[model samples]
Target: MFDWRELLLRNQPQASQTDDTTLKMLEEQLLDLLPPIVSALNAIANLPIEPTWFQSEIAQKFKLMLEGVEQQYLVAWNHVRNAQIQKLEEEYRIWYQAQLRSDKSLYRTYCQWQDLLIQQHAQGWFSWILLGLKEHPFPASELKKGHSFAPETELLLAEFFRCAKPLIQTDTYAVLKNFYSFQAIFTHQSPFLPQLVQGISNSSEKEISEKLEDNEFVEAAKIFWDILIVEN
Candidate 1:
């Protein structure tokens, strides 16, 4: 299990002593360094990695890749040291909002929002990223409000229904709207009722995935609009 937290915490000492301005620069530099390191590790981990089977140059390249990962670790350490908690919270808020609007499926909307809340409590790295991005730091009292990344209320469900009105079939609209109303309860951790889950789940997944995977989102939206024209 690649525990991101463990990797981060273990490297904290190196980052803490680093200057703030240097931190962002270090992160950018290390981001570039991750690919080759990941590639080498992937190659070795995919064994049987017979070092002798490779030419001298190939073996040397693999060794260099491991060294690059080590170097990137140092950069990551600097990022941890200079991490701004306030900035992270802001980033999480932005990401959460973006994800909610992007998620066409009710299931995904529920899952992503729930995950955001859980991650908020755990003080995950992404949470820290959000906190650090906050432009103006507030008092500790405001910090509580700022850090809160819980899902929006049922009013949001009403908004979703309003937005989805034209796209979904009117005959089944009430049934689908009722499903979104139960957002607070539908959790990824538990097994849902087979029939209820299967009914909504199947249609939503196919439609949402197709819409998203299609590069032309506007074109897809137009297709839905054309359905309205045909129905009229």
Candidate 2:
């Protein structure tokens, strides 16, 4: 099993060393990076990947995509070096806010989000690899109040009640919203997904949600997690 904490620690920004200017630069770089990363993930999700392939030659890319974005964002701004990245984020926030007012648009975004997750779920990556990226958090300094990646993250996930107003049709919505909540910015761990995976013989959205709400579902995995965390 992969040690979730290793990825958690690796995902954390070197906020202690990142000055305001550098932080802003890194944020801008991520704003630029995520769209295509999102696209790349979507492309990979549709493929049939064997277990062997994921361990070599960037086949691990899907699992490491977030880390890739963070590292690439921190390394250089060559792509957006001359452009105004802050202004772009502000522009995005404004545009995203407008999307909130249109149920059609927000639902479309929701579908895109759901479709991507479902596709990945088919590949058996949901509980371990994929969900970790969805819920794993960054440092407080990386997600500072309303700046850096904060607005982007919030605008992307912040208020689910509003962003997902038109999205609550089934019990699954309730479960997923909690996972994507904006409050995630303030924390570093989300082993909750795997907790839900315990004792699941076959995985599906419905099955996952059932395990999620059943407290007893994770009873057997308590020792496993304790050992997993310590080993990592």
Candidate 3:
């Protein structure tokens, strides 16, 4: 019953566009893209952190929230964002304890558990990505595509990166670069189950820097996700 056009345009303010205001104007239009994605994200995060935390009921609700996406990429992104949330919470707790001058030994075991749990949660990211790609290979025409000419695609790419970058580690320059989640899936405990799995077995990294112009970073992430979801 939800119209995506209405969702994407609701409460979105149109800014004045000068000749030099091309991408700036575009980012404002893209800003409305967060509402549904953020809503879905908040819905499922009530679960305890564990391997079987993704329940069928929750998955169904999540599926409804993102009707057009493949299940696996959605799952992958969910895990990735959860890991980020856990990491941020852990970091905040550490800062709080430091301020209180708490003894380090009191929270050592809990911190260790947080580290391992975050890793475990993030492990299946690209494996799901691999399986999704194997099931539905991207159209050849969509590979490494740019949003420079396509305003709609630009808005979509910007939203995906905005949702996804939270879980991905960034460097000093604010570029999302590290994807060590590959290390988890390839390890002994977690295995890629596809019989003829075609995926990037090694660590996958990207060079999209957020320090660039808002739209440029979105365009850079366009290439990243194009390669990520479709390039297998």
Pairs with steric clashes in candidate 2 = none
lDDT of 1 by residue, 1-232 (tens): 1222344457656767767676555555444434433444343322212223322344355556345445545444545533543344344345435534776522243345334433432224223222222312223232123223222222222223333433444334443433323321232223133433344446554564366354333333333322222222
Worst 10 residues of 2 by lDDT: 219-228
Give the per-residue lDDT digits (tens) of candidate 3, residues 1-232: 2333443243233312223254343334334433444343343332222343343344455445345332322232234344543454355445435523643322232243234433432334323333322323333244334333244334333533443443444331122222213222222223223411233322333235442334354665555544444453
State which candidate, 1 or 3, has the greater lDDT. Answer: 1
Which wins on lDDT, candidate 2 or candidate 3?
A: 2
lDDT of each: 0.37, 0.39, 0.37
How well does candidate 2 match the true structure in TM-score terms? 0.24
Off by over 4 Å in 1: 1-9, 48-65, 68-232
Q: Whose lDDT is higher: candidate 1's or candidate 2's?
A: 2
lDDT of 2 by residue, 105-139 (tens): 52234445444443433123233233333433446
> Can you give the lDDT of residue 192 in candidate 1?
35
